[model samples]
Target: MIVDKKNDATGVLLRNGHIVLPDKTYVGDLRIRDGVIAETGQLEPEEGERTLDCSGCYVLPGGIETHTHLQLESMGTVTADDFETGTRAALYGGTTTVLDFATQFHGESMAEGLARWHKKAENNCYIDYGFHMALTEWNADLKSEMASIVEGGISSFKIYMAYKNNMMLQEDEIYDALSETKRLGATVGFHCENGLLIDVLVKEAKARGNTSPWYHQWTRPPVFEEEAITRLETVNALLHADHYVVHLSTADGLDAILKARSSGIDVIAETCPQYLLLDNTRYGTEMSEDFEAAKYIMSPPLRDKSHQEPLWDGLACGDIQFVGTDHCS
Candidate 1:
């Protein structure tokens, strides 16, 4: 965890690392020159070079954080972290890059939306960042804009199955978005959940006086998400396009994704730390003492304790390909 004061030409030698890989780990050394890796092996430190002793520590690539929401205004509340603090946190966690969503609200221009995210991040962020436009409202003109966006250096897109009233795209609209992405040779990621079903469940919970933090989980059960993923898998089959599911929370949802993949559906599964570690028990805690459990209330709410082991097992077996914090703040 130490850095050297030597000049760029001198380069710092990171000595004796427990290097990690997809399949294994090994002891090695890495050389950094002018802020980039120059060499790695049983490297001998150059004369007068700065050196960082990484003895007994793991050397790994800076993580590529694929999901984050910074400086986002949603449901009448601004998120906790802005670009500066969010990227700082990522760097602290060993992530050097982030791919955050740049949202185009209903009736907003795509160019303007991308520009706004840029202004928030360009000079202010502490680490590298990129944007994935969340296509909230799609139409003929907006669909045509996809090509220009890709040419402008942003390629992937997103659609929400939740946020039906505000950000969600229906099944047909979802197809259209994925079709456009396929035409542009790009991919579309979805927030999988039946927004309509969730709405009904939420109202039911409220009418029954179940307004505690726990009510959020009741409104969006595992089947709600599993249904959405199942539906999207069918559509992705027809379109045969590049696709992804974001923040997959339930074990049943993971089961659906694995089924699709096993059947040769080319799709990526992305899950978050909350799903892998936490559970709906937090809601019960919030109901009892810690009112802050409401803070844990998010779309595709956490599942039962039984889901935790399955999600971890899925990650271990490669059914789930990657992980993120889903760091909205």
Candidate 2:
């Protein structure tokens, strides 16, 4: 049995379920009032309260999705799911909160980008939401706005090492942004892949007339990801700032992060299910012929199956802190 809080204003009482809490788990009763958990542990149904029998269910806290791209414009296209659809899907999956990126384009102000995202999400999201500002360009003016943005509740930021002409920042610009974020006590997330090298590789592939989607994986191999992460490590080693690596896809990149953390650099990372459960073989003959391979074309493209075990081990040992979907939709 289940109670629909949307229809029942009185409240809900759930009985005889496995309640999972931070420190322990037990079979207990839980109550919710006004959409928030009101009590737990052998709770009794109040007068006029709605009740649900949870004989064999695991009641847990709602999830927080740390990475998502909703209603975002990139590479001449916008992602399929806007805030409304995306947040609704998240809620259906038990995720109660989401953090989507509000990206500042190359010539745009950070504030303007933030405003654009707010306009897209306002009164549209089905659950709690927040933004991580993705800064494409760093300048005196943009740096000046960091404090106010942080004050306005956007404390984490993102920078791309890929997407060269459209979103990537120069090494110096990245360094300066890191410096400013460190001073403001904010965190920065990175999309680490060597964009310039990828461009050269892409041109080489096209010149060979290998323009199929399979070439997408071939051109941007794991080495480029390792190289970019190593470069960022060098920068962060000097600054000692708290940083996050998003959608880490390769074993070599994970090794670099492990090395950085061992040396006391405050760096953490996340990998998506695609990296753990899928592999580069998706770009092989069968999928590519149908253009289904296009679905797997993403930055730091999927890696060899050999990389999966190490990533799983990393998660088990706490080397990787979170598993985000990098949910583009």
Candidate 3:
């Protein structure tokens, strides 16, 4: 079992392990003092120092989870894991830091949303944590609050182009918010899906007597995601804003991003493991009850298997910058 060496004043030495670095990997020793790495390379144990023989083991840096949704409430249900349970699980899996979305619900101030999240996480996280304020509503007052939010240490913000009547902002609002965030030198991330089109599609599906989980994927196709992404990128290009696309899951969407970046748009993107490893087939599976497919339901729902390779390729070529779990639980 691994041990916690946070209070080891005399320091702890990890010897004879293969250390993985950005550009190279080599067998070496790493020494830690006061809970931080103090040195590396060939080293002998000093008096009062605790040494661990790490033969045949590999040492790597801790992970930073770029997206998470701990203790979040949605659709009249709260997530299964709170900040305490979620962060503890993250730590167990080697994530050292997590950036969670502090959502500002409609009709609420950004500060109130952030304060609610802080209350839930202040004494609950097991690892370092930060917030990316998600602005569900935008206005002159909300725009003014951006500065204070930044000053309070939130350098990133999130907006949704989907979830109309709930978390989504209009195109003009998104453009204005992006402009404000850009002016403040902060990055904005987006949930890009065509909420309006989705609503129409859902209604059409239900009218046709299709109410199964399979209709969930059928109603929100890849083109909706592509359309929303293209729209966001077009707006950002006009503003030259540094922005991010969260939970990107389609080849069409990736193509839109690639085209935008080729023209020098300052946009970055992230994808979840679900998109990389799973596909829409999960929704059509004839296993258990049809509702079983609900387990895989998420925005920008999984695409066809044909789309997976492009996503993997995007990651390998550095077109996609992060792989977050979008860990709702």
**Residue 166 lDDT in candidate 2:** 77
Model 3 stretches with alpha carbons more than 4 Å out: 1-6, 286-291
The residue-by-residue lDDT of candidate 2 on 66-167, one tens digit each, is 999999897689999998889889899999899999988877888999999999999898888899999877789999999999999999999999877778
Give TM per candidate: 0.94, 0.94, 0.94
Instruction: Using lDDT as the measure, name the better of candidate 2 and candidate 3.
Output: 2
Give the distance in Å from residue 177's predicted Cα in candidate 1 to where it truly belongs. Answer: 1.4
For model 3, residues 89-117, the per-residue Cα lDDT tens digits are 99989898999999888788889999999
Give the Cα-based TM-score of candidate 2 against the true structure.
0.94
Winner on lDDT (1 vs 2): 2
lDDT of each: 0.86, 0.89, 0.88
Q: Residue-pair clashes per candidate, as listed?
A: 0, 0, 0
| Candidate 1 ranges beyond 4 A from true positions | 1-7, 285-289
